[model samples]
Target: MSIEKHDASVPHTGVGSDLAEEPIGNPGLPAHTWRPTDVDDGAAKRAERQVAAMFVGAMVCSVLFVVVYFTAEIGDNQDVFLGLGASNLGLGLTLGGALLLIGVGVIQWARKLMADHELVEMRHPAKSSEEDVATTVAALSAGAEESGIGRRPLIRNTMIGALGMLGLPAVVALRDLGPTPGDALYSTIWSEGMRVARDVLGTPIKVSDMEIGDLINGQPMAIFEVDEEGEPLVEGVELYVAKSKASVVLVRMEPDEITPGEGRENWSVDGILCYSKICTHVGCPISLYEQQTHHLLCPCHQSTFDLADSARVVFGPAARALPQLPLAVDDEGYLIAQSDFTEPVGPSFWERG
Candidate 1:
């Protein structure tokens, strides 16, 4: 499309010239260009087949996504491709190709097959009258008819099949939500005699290692334990899952400053106390400590718990106190857990009675 230029030297002497002078002549709509598919029946048929082929390709990709999701190994036994996991690479390419093909096919259908008439919509008030609403409905019906969806069985059927195939991936993904958590959320790797070790380095912590107002991010020693072969007892995804649930924060304060809850008189050793690092509100690791107040703040939601008072929720959105792990001195003077947490850790769930 090209715009026609107007000469400013010419004086406006037309019917509306007395009211206002025209700075530039209004350029009307350009001549409509006809596509080969619009004029030739053979070209239109070929375009229809090309669109159907794309929809078929989309269906194939969607099917491949489901196949890769089930057959591809994940976690420790995962296969590698170009320095990335094969499962991830395959799933991404297949799903992405499926979406891309569908989008391209829709664009091609509109450009080559749909009604090519150039229309100009006049500006109107925001409010639509009843007659305008009826016209809009009629226009939509006309558009559907012009698109030839009812006449093109191949394109319509293949497109529907491609869209239906997309749902298979979603259905397959639902499996990840389960093997139902069962009693897993109610307990963690923590058990009798599991020593409290510092995070990352995993070195066991002794009472002497902590000072007044000191806070240590710790985890269960089992994560660091090695087998007779010198390999980690827990590795890969298993290690991650264990660490997330069994993580703890050790805090030390004045012995008199501590207020033990009912049945938790012996839960702490000396002035040192241990609580689940996971926030009670959402499960974000809570390590932001205010030593003077003995409060543990969750950075994610600002849920604060008073470590000096049975890890009680003193402020913010936490609905319950942080779960305390019963502490005991091992034969080697390292801090050890007396048992698993008396209650479930992390955010409360529906079945948590």
Candidate 2:
């Protein structure tokens, strides 16, 4: 704790200079006191062992976190403890313990085993001289020597092991991101004969229900169908996934104003056309429409699509046209899908080809 104060009257130019200007006199550091571990060989050994134990505990906790991740069930049948899922509880406790033990181990090592000497540096020019750089390097070397990293193999090895083992939790957790979508992104629940219905109300839409200059948010009728027991056929995450891909916008315009793509002459019913609601740029739902221009706009990035002519990207960052769902009329006159989308819907991906 002994501090050497700089003389204010003299200017400091480089390292080893005891000269620097200060606004006031220095309040020197208190007298130095040696720690118990520094004075006693037995205490030093005990402290070293304690730090190594904590690092070893961190390593164990880290391993346990990975084990729990693989063994614990995540859904309905998952084990619960104190109102929390066993999977989550085990993960939190093990990961938290690993971090806590490592932190405590570092604190103990610094406080008890590492050098406890105090240092004081006076203000000097921003740029250091060659001599100052050399001195700094020497000081760093001395610090490494005093830290006992080279001399104490137990603490060093345990610390390295703990740090290395901590990466296991992160590596194993990446499994949760998959299994890859595969062909799921290429299709939806809009197979042939699936009726088109209003999005939230789930009411079937007929060609007569839509007038010229009208735009309606719609989804496949399969989601609204219920079982004989009066329970929803599609519910929960399944319903959400189906709605995300099957969602569409039905627009009605003057048939003469429409310009059908080659081989898509009968894709629309009269003047009414159906296209996926998802934007081609980034899978954002698009509803903003200009009935006068027969253009659909995605609010997310101002991507404009010409619904009058195959829903092609007319503006903004969208790279492709909106996927069209061919329309057909059922026996009851309700709008039904001629078939699933001819192409994949939503944002473009590497496997989209």
Candidate 3:
């Protein structure tokens, strides 16, 4: 068949006609500019030094943390800071600076030294041809080569070693968590004649000092008193541990309101009685009280105990009653421990024997 020509005045809608009308050709890519660190030897060297300095700072901070842990006394009035303990301040600052330095170092290395390139990839259908898969694998291998991870054995090994060493501090610190409590929870420093004192402040309590319906959180006088030499009485980790376990609540009820437990007839002096402040439910300190009902409540888990009935668990999830510390009056009329608690304090644990 012979082809017929269209009129010149007509608009064209043919395939070759569309190609001719389309945007002329590919615009092609913009020129690439290399970073100073990539082109200049001096800039690369400077960036490398800056990154090394940050890592060195991190190492120094880590060392300082270990030093502070040993040198700083944990709870001496001597180590007081701006109302915070100096020991805590030093530990927090050193450890935090170490982590911050590592983070900053990584950011600087990436920004000032590492390669920077912008890429444009064409979107395609989800399925790929076998050739595309091969190309992808080759690209990944090329990227690894460009990253220099295999070539730079020193940096690779150093990074691995540093990260591995970080685990050592954690393991070493676990030593502080335990040799286990042993029978410490079952007993305290509250021996016979040891005066009951305010927790932390350590002021001795007299029967006359407390008013009826009053509850004062207290600890043993041993925490504060010095030996004959005038040296610190309780000077180490043992002191803090003792103070924590020996905490008590001294409550004064009317003589008529007191009903002592069996074998606890003389535990109170003129209706002022003492009980272990540590809750039996989960070991939270208990002090919330209903003076009228003589009921003591643990704030955690709402474990209620009847203080009048020997601190029996009257309600809530408490598995056992609060432990009562037997009390007596010393020669000076200060409230004293008749003995250490007859039962374990705080949450029940195995080996409390």
- Residue 329 shift from truth in candidate 1, angstroms: 2.9
Q: For model 3, how does the per-residue alpha-carbon lDDT over 1-353 read when each residue is reduced to its tens digit?
A: 01123333433233222133432233453455677888898997787677667667677777777777778787444486787888789878988887787788667766765555543233445898897799789867866775555754544454454455455456656868879666666677889888999877878988889999999999898889887888777879888888778889988888778777888888888988888888887789888999999999888889998887788889999888778888888888898888888887888776654
| Candidate 1 TM-score to native | 0.67
User: Candidate 2 residues 1-353, lDDT tens each?
Assistant: 22344555544233223445434443553456789999999999999999999999999999999999988898979988898999999999999999999999999998999887655565567899898899889978988998999999999999999999999999998888867688999999999999999999999999999999999999999999999999999999899999999999999999999999998999999899999999999899999999898889999999999999999989999999999999999999999999999999999999888
* Model 1, C-alpha of 349: deviation from truth (Å): 4.4
RMSD of each: 6.9, 4.5, 11.8
- lDDT for each candidate structure: 0.88, 0.91, 0.75
What is the full ranking by TM-score, best candidate first? 2, 1, 3
| Stronger candidate by TM-score (2 vs 3) | 2
255 Cα displacement, candidate 3 (Å):
2.3
Spell out the clash pairs found in candidate 2: none
Model 1 C-alpha lDDT per residue in residues 1-353, reported as the tens digit of each score: 11122345533222222224445443553456889999999999999999999999999999999999999999999999999999999999999999999999999998899987643333346899897899889878978998989999999999999899978878888888867677889999999998999999999999999999999999999999999999999999889999999999999999999999999899999999999999989889888999888888899989889899999998899899999999999988999999999999999999888
Ranking by lDDT: 2, 1, 3
Model 3 residue 220 CA deviation in Å: 0.5
Ten residues in sequence with the least summed lDDT for candidate 3: 1-10
TM-score of model 3 (CA atoms): 0.51
- Candidate 2 structure, TM-score to reference: 0.81
User: Candidate 2, which ten residues in sequence have the lowest lDDT sum?
Assistant: 10-19
Q: Summing lDDT over every window of 10 consecutive residues in candidate 1, give the lowest-scoring window.
A: 10-19
Q: Estimate each model's TM-score.
A: 0.67, 0.81, 0.51
